[model samples]
Target: MVTSNDLLIKQRSVIKFLAAEGCSAANIHAKMKTVYGEMCISDCAVRKWVRIFKGEDPREIILRDRKRSGSPLSALVTAHQEKVDCMIRANRRVKQKEIANAVGISKERVHHIITTVLGYLKVSARWVPRQLTVEMKAQRKDMCTQLLELSTVCPRMY
Candidate 1:
């Protein structure tokens, strides 16, 4: 089935053609229901388009969709990011819903926190480990170097 967007595009094209043919708004709206079936463009929309075509140069009018402010990002889970991280660290197998329920936030917000701020993704339905901080990397390097020095000093241990 054609989506609402696709139907709008189709209706706009029809409106352009009807306008070029010098058809009235009422005429266009009347034909719309029969031509487009249940997805017919509303008469109010037809009237609006009629006004647009009448007052403005149709050729220069941009057919692009108007910009819209989409749904706002809810970051209620952000304060809980560290807590969630700790929980996951304690048990990587814990479910997102469980965490959300435990923390009292939407699972989607929890998901955003886990994947974005924490930089984690499910590996086999389990979150991938967060990236190590610079200090952690440095400490690990020093530990490996000390282990190498010890191995050299006591060769038999290798």
Candidate 2:
């Protein structure tokens, strides 16, 4: 069976190729739905790609994601990485925009540093460890196994 993920990647490339040919989002959606039948490329995704293509030169529609210019001024400076770290430490619940403003960088850069460098993720308005420890993962897996067993035994209340 073709996994849904594989289908999605295929759909994205097809959509990108179609968009590059100057097909409108609606037209592309219609064509893909007609040609591929069950593989439904979301309208939101098509629209997003259309907008992205518009920003790029029409003649150069690459199927894959393109790289950005570089990190923002505040993020580019090696000194600012430490500053960003301190800011996040000081306020774990700080917003990306707030960090950007304080650090003199774009919200994207703040996000990059947080994820790539600081190795933190914002969950429920708090910065938390992104990856769980191996032991924690194993414990969570065991808990899930018990939950699955319980569900199999119990009758659905609903």
Candidate 3:
């Protein structure tokens, strides 16, 4: 699938090429409108790019979008996941907000890591593995079998 960023780059490249050929911004926008239709960028945006391409040094014409200065969109790196897992294992009843503060992430991300990534669930105010281990399964089966035998031996106590 062609992403919006890719489409923007395509349009920027076209703008640069047309500007190099001395085509006015109005003419370039008109041509792009016919080709891109509803997907076409605004005339103001076309004019901005045209001015950038025409005014800037020829060697500095960047077709790709520049990186912006801000916090990243996600902090779901493996280090953060590992830290969250360790914190949970160390204290199953630890709060998500505490984990987020310690791990330098958001509470929602910590919850996501615990429930989705680590396969844990909140049970009785504590974090527990969603799936039982083999030993736990066997222990439960043995207890059930013992109860069944006792109920059969003492039918009146059922």
Best by lDDT: 3
Where model 2 places Cα greater than 4 Å from the true spot, the runs are 1-76, 131-158
C-alpha lDDT of all candidate models, in order: 0.81, 0.78, 0.89
TM-scores for all predictions: 0.44, 0.36, 0.67
The TM-score of candidate 1 is: 0.44
For candidate 1, what is the total of clashing residue pairs? 0
Scored by TM-score, the top model is 3
Instruction: Tell me the tens digit of each residue's lDDT in model 2 across 9-98.
Output: 677787778777889989988887887786787778777767667765355655544678965455557777888888877888888889
lDDT of 1 by residue, 1-158 (tens): 87788778878878877987899989999999888877887898888787676666354443458778965565543558878888898898899999999877789888888888788878887877678889999999999999999999999997
Candidate 1 weakest ten by summed lDDT: 55-64
RMSD of each: 9.9, 13.9, 4.8
- Candidate 3: where is the Cα deviation over 4 Å? 56-61, 71-74, 97-109, 131-158
Total clashing pairs for each candidate = 0, 0, 0
lDDT-wise, the better of 1 and 2 is 1
Query: Model 3, residue 113: displacement in angstroms?
Result: 2.5
